[model samples]
Target: MQYLFRLSAIYVRHRRLALAFFCLLQAQAAVAGDLFHTDNADLYSRAFAVVPAAISGDTQLKFGDTPPNLRLRNSLIIGTGAALVAVYGSNNWWQSGFGGGFDTTNEGWFGSGTKFGGADKLGHAYINYAGVRLLTPLFESAGNNRDDSLSLALWSSLGIYTAVEVVDGFSHNWKFSPQDAIANVSGAVLGVALETHPGLDAMFDFRIDYRRSPRSPKFDPFGDYSAQKYLFVVKADGFASLRENSFLRYFEIAAGYGTGGYDTGGNHQRSTYAGLSLNLSRLLADDAYGGHMHATAFQRGTDRLFDLVQFPTIGYARRSLD
Candidate 1:
């Protein structure tokens, strides 16, 4: 019991680090599935380029707050791994007659469809929220500038969305949903807008809407033919940091709104789902060689444990000390 309490306290202290690390790692590993395919590399590259330029206003790339890493190799490993996972999992789901498709809505991010419906599939939006929260923190840690983080988030989101589209583009069960990709990028950009542009704070936030329709090509061929009505959720979330001095480590919080319900043709019915989006991530270590390590462990104990146990095991011993 003592150990449990100690662990709890430890986690409390390092919660931000744990959360950030885990989320970034998850985003790095899981979210890239739809971002890396070659079907439209040129278009994607251009789309990705537009985001950084638009968001940052400078030509510099937003590669996280961390320094120096090979772009191509890093993107490939993250992208390919995510794509394969999506494909493998997608195939498994398709066998059960679950072919994913795009939403048809103008209200989404940049006017794209990304909703998925059908009663049993309500939890998919949760997966997307997890990804966004995890990825968003990667941008929050910078001293003040979030444009880079926002740009990186959108770029990564687009990369994953594209990869999924590419895989679907070739598959027999689903066609590439470029519109969905647009929605994703737009949603990510919206997230950035909320963070960077204070004016949007009152009007915008993180949102997820899922729909399953019989008339839509992506779902009609499967099996059930009823005009299936599912759920639509909207959330307004943000992340901020608290600094005491240059020495005391950084603190952060991510908060948002979530709402959903069944949308039966004529009018979209709804449900109330309000929650907070909170996460705390900090830099674990910075090296003289332009290299650094970071983690998002959510509690002080876990954060410390990561520093003590995981650090030595991974040759990042210095992070533990930091």
Candidate 2:
């Protein structure tokens, strides 16, 4: 009874921000392509048509009398690591062995190691930015409130960047970048700012390139295959929080895909996918504390359509502000 009440209070407190965030994401996602192909009105028209339906669906799912509950059983689950302890506990270990001391000496992008120069730094930033944008819901729970969500965004981005830096700093093969870490946090905050602020919303479109071959084949996994395809994809993806009731997690999924093909397909393909995701935290226990499974079917140029299942790990929190 006490636990249920506490959860309810959390949900009610952060309800508006959570929903606003979700709706803004859906709206942004629906029209994301417009920012790229400023010339294509028809493509954007179709995307705009889907926004109301998406918002309506979100509302109905929440208002439904019986909510979905597919969380993993108790025996399978364990709570997250003790928050404060995790930060302090791992400090000494990282500093001593990982050469974790900050370097005021190494300056500029890729200055410590390989130099594709600025492009390499940009490519790495893209992934970190995308990762943060996609994983917002898990860390920014409505149950915690708006300030919590914002805090989560800032801290989680920092934490992830720090963890990655620590690993790279200590690893025998790689050099750590305080610069890369700064870029990631900057991009994440920029992404969140784009979503929340009206005047700057349109500034969300930016591309970072990942080079092949002469750039660094060893680190590039796509180099394994004989086919080297340059894919130009316009993607808008997000996770939304379901209302707190009987369910653990629920999110609407939608994506528009336009890839410049290298083959005989006239160098283009237009695709759209829509589906629902189920959070599987209760099932997997360890791997899925706040994780989810996305099931989507995509249509590609008449006959080339397919379905996919992606289970993304829940993002770690950026804040310790309990």
Candidate 3:
């Protein structure tokens, strides 16, 4: 009974925070107007028009048939509340790494000698950032406005991830990592900011690529730190000026970091890299490839996929920083 009550309380508290902040964002959004395309009369402004917002980098928004007779406040409350419930379940997920009591550990950040060579930190960030983007679509599909959906995604992500850290504070194997907390905040903020400003979102993508080392120990895919790389990608297609340049539109620039020989292998080293990369998303959306004036579902999927996973075959490594 006590355990159930505690679990219930967790959801209740976070829901309150979700509601409070969502209400505040609702006000701000009212002033800001529609978040995606500036002009509703634009071709893509129609519901799920399957058209990308030119070079602005706004993803396909499902501007739903939410009835105008319905008050925006009530719609927002119902929509955001449903999303929070789905993401923030009423259960104590803290049973893992079950420590009898509270504990602590000092895990340094990004040092060659540190655990997994800071891969876990980047992992934390990536998951949070991805979570926000992924969750926003659910609200959008449910007829929630872009502003409410995005704000809910942001607040729910932080509240849920932070709750995990708090639970770690009480566990035995893992102590709460302040560094992980900071990364969570950073990623969540980046996700919301990019969604807000499509131009900036156009120029950058945070991604992970994996190429297993020959000597790597056979650990689980995620724990196989030797095989993972984190990247930031800048796409030329994001610039309207480059769109007409047949060759340059698909060009990209990438920089990334990785670690080798860790996770039970010998001789660990940190690797940094720079490279020329292809914009697979733009390639699919191009007219020469039977694409249209705007992005299609297939093209949109490619863009979202590349946001997290970098396809190594399409990218060229210029040099490495050992």
Cα lDDT of all candidates, in order?
Answer: 0.36, 0.34, 0.64
Write model 1 residue lDDT over 1-322, tens digit each, in one string: 9999999866643543333233334556533324322223344355344333244446454654332222433455445546554544344423332224433223232111223222222222223333444444443342213444454455555555454445444444555454555545555554455546654442233333223453444542112212322112111221222232333323221222221222223332222232322112134332221212232334433332321111111110111100
Superior candidate under lDDT, 1 versus 3: 3
User: What global local distance difference test value does model 1 have?
Assistant: 0.36
Cα RMSD for candidates in order: 19.5, 21.8, 10.5
How high a TM-score does candidate 1 get? 0.35
Deviating ranges (above 4 Å) for candidate 3: 1-97, 212-221, 287-294, 316-322
lDDT of 3: 0.64
**For candidate 3, which ten residues in a row score worst on lDDT?**
88-97
Pick by lDDT: which candidate is best? 3
Clashing pairs counted in every model: 44, 5, 2
Q: In angstroms, give how far residue 288 of model 2 lies from its true place.
A: 32
What 10-residue stretch in candidate 2 is worst by lDDT? 70-79
Among residues 3 or more apart in sequence or in different chains, the pairs in candidate 3 whose N, CA or C atoms overlap within 3 Å are 52-295, 99-172
Clashes of 1: 44
